[model samples]
Target: MHNPSSTQVKIVTADPSAIGLFGLAIVTLVASSQKLGLTDGLSLVIPWAIFLGAFAQLFACIHDAKHNNTFGMTAFGAYAFFWFATATSWMVKMGVFGSELAGAVDGKQLGFAFAGYLVFTLFMTIGAMETHKVLFFIFVLIDLLFIGLTFDAFGAPEAFHKLAAFAELGIALLSLYGCGAAVLNTHFGKVFLPVGRPFGIFKARS
Candidate 1:
């Protein structure tokens, strides 16, 4: 007679940053086109915002959580919800919810919301500095985007909105690069694309 024993194996998870960055890239690219006056309608932008911006990042957030990456989880989750909220806001603005809801809209509330996200992105920018150059620049552009968005929300100037439009475009470009780097580097098992090293500013000495 023999006794049976069972063994446990840990499952490996793939990095979610590539897909997340791709989502960010597509949505921002589309939305920035509208803000830059290259597009005429939010109707065309809504689906991408909901699917690529909100859903994709939200999916990355779940995987990041599984990987025990606190920063990644928080960043992806926050931006995912931000996109969701923005899509809903656009719907309200377009009177999709109802005329009464659209009529009751308070633009200042958007100001407050953008201001809050600006604050959130600032801290996240610091964290991104530790990741890689591509990601760092992406977050830096994100910070600028939020800054411009915040000011524009509060009626600062058209310049601020323009700044946000450009910054958002920058984010889309950088995110696409990041997505490529993540995929190619992992697939090749080498630094096929240089993302640069993390800054030594914050780590403690050994």
Candidate 2:
């Protein structure tokens, strides 16, 4: 008689947050430039929106799923899709899909979408509180950005547009810092950059 022996194998994966943040940083930086009137036209912005914003975050989302990180996966996935949809909307407005579709464009429809994202981001901002101060503030900026976008879409004053532009620029700067922290901290095997500790308010029971 022989006794059976079992061996367990665990797969290790790198954290995808750095790349995800990098993607977010790049896209927001470029988009904010346009929103701030520093740049013109969506022609160049669409490619970056699709490639960096959509695909890169989507790549992070997949790896985060493999890591069983629900928060990272959901956050990256939702933002990835948001970029994808935004890109498509830009294309449609640009008449890439044909004149008829572009002619039917309604700013109010986009307003509704922005409003919905605002609602989604509010909950996500709450969730980010347990992550880190850097991430929490990033979410806060994103919330402000969406608020401005939602109001601007609905024909709000120019101030709201400026609000969105500045908020988006803030997001870009913070995300760049977060990306650097994620990479350097991991590479150095130490806290090379401090992202601040989580608030510890809503931690799940072990």
TM-score of each: 0.95, 0.96
On residues 75-115, what C-alpha lDDT tens digit does candidate 2 reach at each position? 99999999999999999999999999999999999999999
Model 1: per-residue Cα lDDT at residue 77:
93
**Which numbered prediction scores highest in lDDT against the true structure?**
2
Give the whole-model CA lDDT for all candidates, comma-separated: 0.93, 0.96
Show model 2 residue runs off by greater than 4 Å: 1-6, 204-206
| TM-score of model 2 (CA atoms) | 0.96
Report each candidate's C-alpha RMSD, comma-separated, in the order given. 2.0, 1.7
In model 1, pairs of residues that clash are none
The lowest-lDDT stretch of 10 consecutive residues in candidate 1 is 197-206
Off by over 4 Å in 1: 1-6, 204-206
- Cα deviation in Å at residue 30, candidate 2? 0.3
The sequence of per-residue lDDT tens digits that candidate 1 reaches over residues 1-206 is 89899999998999999999999999999999999999999998999999999999999999999999999999999999999999999999999999999999988898889889888988888888788878889999998998888888888979999999999999999999999999999999999989988785787322
